[model samples]
Target chain A: MITAERKPLDEILSYIKPFKRILLLGCNECVTVCAAGGRKEVGVLASGIQMSMLKNGASIEIREHTLERQCDPEYVEELVPIIDSADAVLSMACGCGVQQLATRFKDKPVFPAVNTKFMGGSDRHGVWTERCQGCGDCLLGVTGGICPIAKCAKQLMNGPCGGSVSGVCEIGDEVECAWHLIWERLKALGLTDQYLEIMPAKDWRAGGGSGPRKIVREDLAE
Target chain B: MKTQSNLEKVLSGGHLAVTSECGPPRGASAQTVVDKAKYLEGVVDAVNITDNQTAVVRMSSLAGSVLVKQQGMNPLLQMVTRDRNRLAMQADILGAYALGIDTMLCLSGDHTKFGDHAMAANVHDIDSIQLIQMVKGMRDEGKFQGGAEIKGVVPKMYIGAAANPFADPFELRVMRLAKKIAAGADFIQTQCIFNIEKFEKWMEGVRKMGLHEKCYILAGITPMKSVGAAKYMKNRVPGMDVPQELVDRMSGVAKEDQPAEGIKICLETMERLKEVEGVAGFHIMAIDWEEKVEEIVKQAGLYPRPQV
Candidate 1:
């Protein structure tokens, strides 16, 4: 899931200060799972903004709605009827969702309330850790399921660099060395032969190094 | 000989090789490199010029290597994966070879967090192992990493890589060395040896795997200048192992005699490592203390380096 955190209240307020009526949107997808831009968060933000505005001796109208998935065009179109009543659309979803709303409603100003951090999963309650870099090419099978592209600070492929000490990265103590985990896992699984083989230099073109990437599925196209 | 480099000739001639590091100055001072090279010229087989070692910005190792070459010394040009992508690396290899540097060391390099510029983004586009393979391919296959054949005068390099016996997952350190050797590392320069027992144990593994026979393994040595330097490496430096006893030994000595004690300890390590089978030679890393190289080399009985 893509994890995110709500932008500071001041930054969000500054974006919508010029508008009278604002449509506060939410996503039930990744942002919802991370509890950053769920329906509950939308309500919390709306009330916070209203109270803050009232304290400043001003009144503003905020209409709240949480879509099944703000990234999809069909779910975004659900706001067509009520979007006209609002001055601007303030999305509590990830960057993809905000862009979706902006693209769908051509003339409306779309503002993001939460900062999309990374494509990751929750480690525990209130803690999310990145697991993949979407490098397009995956070497997880060889690396014993640990993603070096995302986990290793230097993105080393063969093994850990000289800085890995006591299973910790040079970056910090909290960050465990990804290659250490790989080596341990491979040894336990009796697959040290896989670790012995040298991994080639990565072809980063698939990782969006060339440019923004797009996938076209002719079978699913209309 | 692979590249006809003096280090290669020495190692291939069945003699223990002596290599030492020469860190380029942070500022562009060719004279600094020349000054350091003079101390190491006849005392060592090759001078390992670092490429932005520890991620601090420094003179390009290629340029530093050329300056050392100008002084009639073999410069083991050290290139790190942390700074350059394959394109730039290969270009520099070609450029370095064209300018008369033939031996090179491939390293993953220290993280930028340890350097002055912590905010800099690192480019580990190719890890050190792949880099060794890339250099080998360029030399042996006469082809680029993309498989395009070179039109003329391909870079023929004697490739070297770093090894850390003290790093975690100790069981895999030898295997990692095996991968590097398989990837075409002609020689191996290990991290500094403060913990000799662990290093001997690692060499036992190396001998068990018979990797020592395949590549020349140069033991790294860095003499402590002070007690504070010893403790700092023990606490702050990553992958560095400075046993408490060594630190205690340094502190036990008088303040004025610490540097002498440090060199004495270093010479003792060299004497011990000299007897270890499969131990190729030494890589004395007297960083910023180049003048000490001649004394250290002479005192260790490795002076009057073998003329290959």
Candidate 2:
């Protein structure tokens, strides 16, 4: 499960103070699981904004709506009436929802209540860490289950560096060197020999960062 | 200790000490809050400002409590540890005190799921009883919650808390009250009591545990004037239970006499509470009916303290 911490109340409130009407939107995907943005979060933000505004002597109407996945146009289209009616929109979803709302409602100002931090997953309750780097190619089989691209600070796919000391990272004593983790996983998988082999070149194209990437799934298309 | 003593005198000596709760409005608005605070100022002994009541974020309870203090009324700042960690809770307590709001009501608070922000996570750093113990320790030993010594010793303020005799099973209610009293709770406000017989039995159990000797317990009473209100309290509110008889009384009475009927029931409830040996006082939560509270007190003949 993905886990996320909520932003402070005052920070969320300050974003929507300008407009009398706001569309407080949420996404039911990863943001919901992590709790940064979700249906329940939207209600909370709306109530908080409403209560703060009322207590401060300014009464603003906030309309709340949560889309299944704000990144998709189909989901964005569902919120047309809510977006059109409001003077401003507060998207609680991560960067994707914020961008989608902005693109869908170009006329209305969109504010992000959550600071989208990283592409990661949760370890356990209240603990989240970066797990994926979207590094253009699949190489997990070569390095056991661990993704060296994310684990290594420098994304060194080849092997552990000279700075690795006692299984700890060189930059910070607290951090367990990712290469250390990579070695441990390889040992456990009975693939210790895999570390001896050198890694190949990295293609950043398929990672979706270099350019606008698309997947045309002909099987799923109508 | 001067204000401490003066407040004890004020509370123990009666003087129509009033307390009201701000449900941290569903949405934020200053006018409604200011109006509610102003309404309670002349009427109540002290106003209990809720800290994120029901976990749906509104104005900060400390901020609201300070606003109440600014309005010239004593505010018992309510703090819930559901959303904050231990460090923030301790800091906010001192902050509230520094802002001239002394009295505090420490609660475990409702689950975040019951709130509008169910998506919001819960941080149960310490339970309500432990929180009281921590504060009392800080005041008595000049130590923080972690047992570290605090720089300047601050005299302990009058710490009040909640008890729910009607919600939990009879045994657990008394046990919880004992635990709270043992945790250095100066005073306790019970959940609203409708069944006087059950309340009397509960008091007997409390006396047996010797809890009454250690803490002053104020019985909580709610006014059920409308049918809708009664239903909501029964179904929605977790710990509160208004008996069927009161609902019948409200229904039997004519529309015009509903107010009188409610007043009569409440007055009788208070009078019956007076007969109980351990009930120190009553905490009247009349919803929006503050004016009726004075009338109920007068009818019950609770003047200048409960004849202590």
Best by lDDT: 1
TM-score of chain B of 1: 0.99
TM-scores, each model vs. reference: 0.96, 0.56
- Candidate 1 per-residue lDDT over residues A50-123, each given as its tens digit: 99999999989999999999999999888988999999989999999999998999999999999999988877
The superposed Cα distance between candidate 2 and the true structure at residue A105, in angstroms, equals: 42
Model 1 over residues B1-308: C-alpha lDDT tens digits?
77888999999888888999899999989999999889887999999999998899999999999999999999999999988889999999999999999999999888899898899889999999999999999999999998999779989999999999998878888989999999999999999999999999999999999999999999999999889889998998888999999999999999899999999999999999999999899999996788999999988888799988
For model 2, state the Cα shift of residue B84 in Å.
1.0
Clashes of each: 0, 15
For residue B182, give model 1's deviation from the true position in Å.
0.1
lDDT of residue A91 for candidate 1: 96
Q: TM-score chain B for all models.
A: 0.99, 0.90
